[model samples]
Target chain A: MTDNTRRRFLKTLLAGGGLATLTGCDYLSEKTWFRDTLAQGETLSDVVQHAVTPRKAMAREYTPADISPSFRANGTTDPDAVEYRMLAANGFRDYRLKVGGMVENPMTLDLAAIRALPSRTQITRHDCVEGWSAIGQWTGARLSTLVEQARPHPDARYLVFHCADRYGRSHSPYYESIDMEDAHHPQTLLAYELNGEPLPIANGAPLRLRVERQLGYKMAKYVMAIEVVESFDHIAGGKGGFWEDRGYAWYAGI
Target chain B: MARARLRTVYRHPLPVRIGHWVNALCLFILLLSGLQIFNAHPHLYWGSASNFEAPWLSIDYHWSRDDGYSGRTQVYGWQADTTGVLGASPGRNGELEGRAFPSWLTIPGSRWLAMGRSWHFFFAWILVINASLFLIWALFAGHLRRLIPTLEDWRGFGQSVLDHLRLRHPTGEAATRYNILQKLAYLTVIFGLGGLIVLTGLCMSPRMDTVLEPVLEFFGGRQSARSIHFLAAGGLVLFVAIHLFEVIVSGPVNQLRSMITGFFRYRDEPATDSATTRETRHDG
Candidate 1:
């Protein structure tokens, strides 16, 4: 179908498609296990979303005119730790992002080394969970290329990002994770530049993640380390990320 | 005992009965949780991007020496103080809290945005799926016939509105089917507003932009889509409020019973008028 027709069809489907199948399905009432499976709807949503959308489907790119004049930095805009301060003082010259854990070949790459790798530049909108959006141009090395060089173990299912920012009373270092499927996605990047310049401290200088398809929180900033893991259950508070531990969904695709 | 009797008829089919209650419960969950989600930013813009400099709508709380407590709301830059009711209000514990849309109306009753999102998405999926099945079943089962407004209905639509405003209702045969106003309301809610809300919601999802490029264009951009989504949800809330009011005013017991049991006890005396016999013949 033409794009216009497809869009119209989707609109129609959204109005009249899934009602009785979800509401009047007697099988759910008849079976206890079936009823319990509703809790797994999160995982089901993830799987179904992945199944329908092509793996390489790129997020919409914006023109330079579309870029926001001032992209407001949110959450932990600045990390006050001595190590981060020292690195910032020296313009992140000594910053090293360690990629290890379940990888067959663990690697420690610094700013120059990461920049030397192949990179991609794209302008895209950042959608926050707080119902705001801002667009900025980002330049970064493809994460798939980095992971491939690191050579993850066959059992590695997730890539955990450990950052320098500490938050809340617990002073917990901020962290986030993504599955192997997303790790290898073409658009997933280890960004080091924003708006045609080296990323500012407020924008996670040195290194940050740009998981374009997910919400802003999923794009953890202030790079420090990466750990390949089979499961995220034992990391941080065991919910995958600091925010995830605090009730955010680990798979924050939206 | 040689007297008149009340007539009853099957008005709501089984799927319609199930879809109605499910949609109601899902809408309840979605609206509360959606408000909770909206409370996080509490600001809206027209275009794709928004910085503090340019917000079309905002709810804010401020303190000043002259005014110990104050709340302000700005829509399209028009400012108004809504202190005691909107921007700042008494919490459940009777202490003042600064927020738009009180905690009581929110899902978690606190500023837990993550939990609010969870509740919103969970019910959102249910609402979408339930509406979808209802639409398909409605088409095949001939349920759509009752909802789709006829040309005759269009001509009488104004009269129906006037009747409703005057609290005058039809009797016997005329009351059996939905009035023109009711038909129009159902058609708008089920097809127009319902579809718009869902599409706007999908537009807000960053990932769905690829699939919904045309929809996003139609809505202008993400922030505009968000604004439209919020407005559409409000429309649904208004529709429900008026619907419930009419139900109660018309006759709550029989109206609610029709939905719950698929049978409606006729509101007028039976076998006493030509209308009742004509309706019986139509049913046959």
Candidate 2:
């Protein structure tokens, strides 16, 4: 072939190959089997992270000076639930966090009672899955303290956070789950305060979770209940979280 | 009939050829999916946390009564209208969508961060594994030496640059070995930028951050690492562009065949054959 013909051929070949590959990717994304194959990467990441990282390794804590000037509250800022509105109107005085499910001692603790528990204050960076981070000082009851108080059954393998807020137009209640390893992590907290003040309504007021090592979506906001469960199979969409149900990875460590 | 003969010499090894193709595919998917992920929040910041008011780079859009939609891209206070491409692009319905990159340029060709992340991570693992195996093989097989510029290569660096600018590729036996510029480019892309991108990717992972705290610190912070990662990817894209251009200009079919079948053909000039040419004429 002539040089010009060869060059034209090469261009056509590259463009055709690129278009075909992209179309194929979009097609594959819709397939459940292909998605499952992709999910193997998430499973690999989870296992590798757990194996490499020490269980007790703390997420890097920053000083008060490092705190963000304004932390952007994403997802559901204000819960529209009637009970949540009433509790917020009264400064969460009537707010009670229910802790049950596969636990020996199922109990409900109000905000004051939760604050009275062994509290931990930390200035930690909250990394969102969308790729932004904000450092804020959080003070709340250590999640391990709550787990110990609840006295989870030996069979309990996960702690599911049931939040008061409903996300998106679907009005699906926001929920997240963490394995026992993350639930009992030192940095994990049922945070009620941000930057030394009461957590604002925009930032999941009353209470939110602080799973420091994971992405922000794993830290379920506006938490109302903590349920210890053997598995999250029966949970909403059976993916352990609102975002997970919508195709986000359940393991957000990466 | 008087016709010039061509000599064939093995160029790439089997493992190298496989790794090259796998790396190329992984890079293509990684770049497109990464753009999709970047579209979720088309803004980049410096330090750790995003300073919402002062982003280092941001792709955004403004809608006014007069103008239906004006897509704008800002870099360090400098702004430009990048409508229909960078800041905003036409969606599947041909309506302008407020997305950072165009659908054609992104994997899945839609606004889907979760699926994008899945594709990115999956291909990322493959890229890393393929690169690792290639590096180990290259080391044991002495292919690493060919990629590194020696004193002789350094002395010929100026001549090589001039030759490249003139599109004057080496002929005969000289074509069997990499020139100085080729060695430097390969070394930088394979080791420098490649290693940096992987390290920065690890820095972005919260769990990995705990283990690679020193690496994060070296890059300034997680956000900085992320910015560096984007820049490194751009570098790789640029390298691929030039690499392809060189392949086309030099001899597309011969270059491609050399990579695929591990054999390269150069015009056999028996009259010009010297002792030096004969010495370096062994198969790679």
Candidate 3:
């Protein structure tokens, strides 16, 4: 074929291809295939993140000068539950964090025991899904230390955080989960203190997960229990967290 | 005497047309969804950290006895009451809602942040992929040459601006190719601003941050990336407004036809063979 005709033919083919791709996006979004692909996309990002960043790489840390005066607690500001209120009333001295599910040894540790473990202090920014951020110094026990004591079974793949906050009277309580990789990260802390003082009630007093690389919502506040699980399939809404169940991406790293 | 046929040119190639429409759709979805996402937290910051204490930019609504129904915007410590628009507006429900941008302007048209994020991320993939493909194709096909400014373009730029100010458009031979103004604008949109938007967007991703930490550092921090993302989006919105205006001003029928079908008819001059020769050259 002559160059002119070949060019014309190719142009037509390209236009057809472009049109197909555009329509394909529309049709695919409605299909289960697309949803699964997006889910995979989340995993893809996780893989890429792990591949690119060094294992011990930390989230950017700030000095005390950068700390916000009022961090302005997000999500559930106050867990107004009778149990949570009573626990808070007594300075959470009696609070116990149960560590079970897919673990070789199930153990419950009180606030004192948790605070006694070797700790990590980091002044890091908390980026919220809502596009706000705040810096605060978090002092807590390394989650890996707790995971080591719990002795998660080989089948365990995720660390689930069960929290005190339940919104809108949902039958399911507020919870969040992270993969084993995040659970073992050196910076992943079960923070009990903020800005030199004990963590305040609004900021998840007795305990809060500090998965620094992720968004604010992933840091489950007022953590009541820690569960090791192979998958979150049987968890509330089968997505992972309260927000995840409501349609937020379970892997909110991006 | 026999009359010459009116000449037509291949003003827009198939690939260009396809890229244009896809980007347009992506931008529309992105802007609306971005606003929806912004409504989740109406404040913007410069450094990596921000809270109630300080934000370089913030859009919020507050009620006071003196300033009822006022919507405030503060930028770098300078505050203003943009009440009728921006910070707050009459929501879709017709109630005065305190949102950064009104519900009508947001995707899902409600305060469903999760849904907004889903839409944003989904469309973001589409935009990124589509734009990447378009760039590659444009480069390989040499279509980029038409958009990139030259020394001659610089010489003609002032004239083009003057003509634009007077609402004058090129005629005949000059109209066959994009004017300097068009080239510069297209180049900025395609190469400069488009890449900035995408890079800043990637920088905002917590996962991508791990992968692109060094690149994100160039933008300063995550919050800086977010701020740049929003600002670049504003530039895009401005481009679309001016683009649509130019389309209408330059003869929407001809512009629309060229983009839709790749055929553009020039002004008729039955006695002129120059137009036909030039058209043939373009076709060849």
Best by DockQ: 2
- The DockQ-based CAPRI class assigned to model 2 is high
Q: Show model 1 residue runs off by greater than 4 Å.
A: A1-41, B1-5, B64-69, B267-284
lDDT of each structure? 0.82, 0.90, 0.81
Write the candidate numbers in order of decreasing DockQ.
2, 3, 1
Query: Which one wins by lDDT: 2 or 3?
Result: 2
Candidate 3 global lDDT: 0.81
List, in the given order, the native-contact fraction of each candidate. 0.46, 0.76, 0.48
lDDT minimum window of 10 residues, candidate 3 chain B: B268-277
lDDT of 1 by residue, A16-107 (tens): 65443333333243454643453354555566667767877788989999999987788789899999999999998899989999988999
Candidate 3 per-residue lDDT, tens place, A1-254, comes to: 99699779868986887556544544554565655665554565667667777776677777889887877688787898899999999989889999999998899999889989999999987888888777899999999988999899998999999999887557468899998988989889999999989998889888999998888889999999999999999988898988888778777877
User: For each candidate, what's the DockQ?
Assistant: 0.26, 0.84, 0.32
lDDT by residue (tens digit), candidate 2, B72-179: 999997999999987878889998878888999999799999999999999999999999999999999998987888897788788778778877777777788888
Q: Tell me each candidate's i-RMS in Å.
A: 6.4, 0.8, 4.3
Per-residue error for B208 in candidate 3, Å, reads 3.1
Lowest lDDT 10-mer window, candidate 1 chain A?
Answer: A20-29
TM-score-wise, the better of 2 and 3 is 2
| TM-score-sorted candidate list, best first | 2, 1, 3
Let me know the DockQ for model 2. Answer: 0.84
lDDT of 2 by residue, A97-141 (tens): 999999999999998899999999999888889999899999999
Question: Of the candidates numbered 1 and 2, which has the greater DockQ value?
Answer: 2
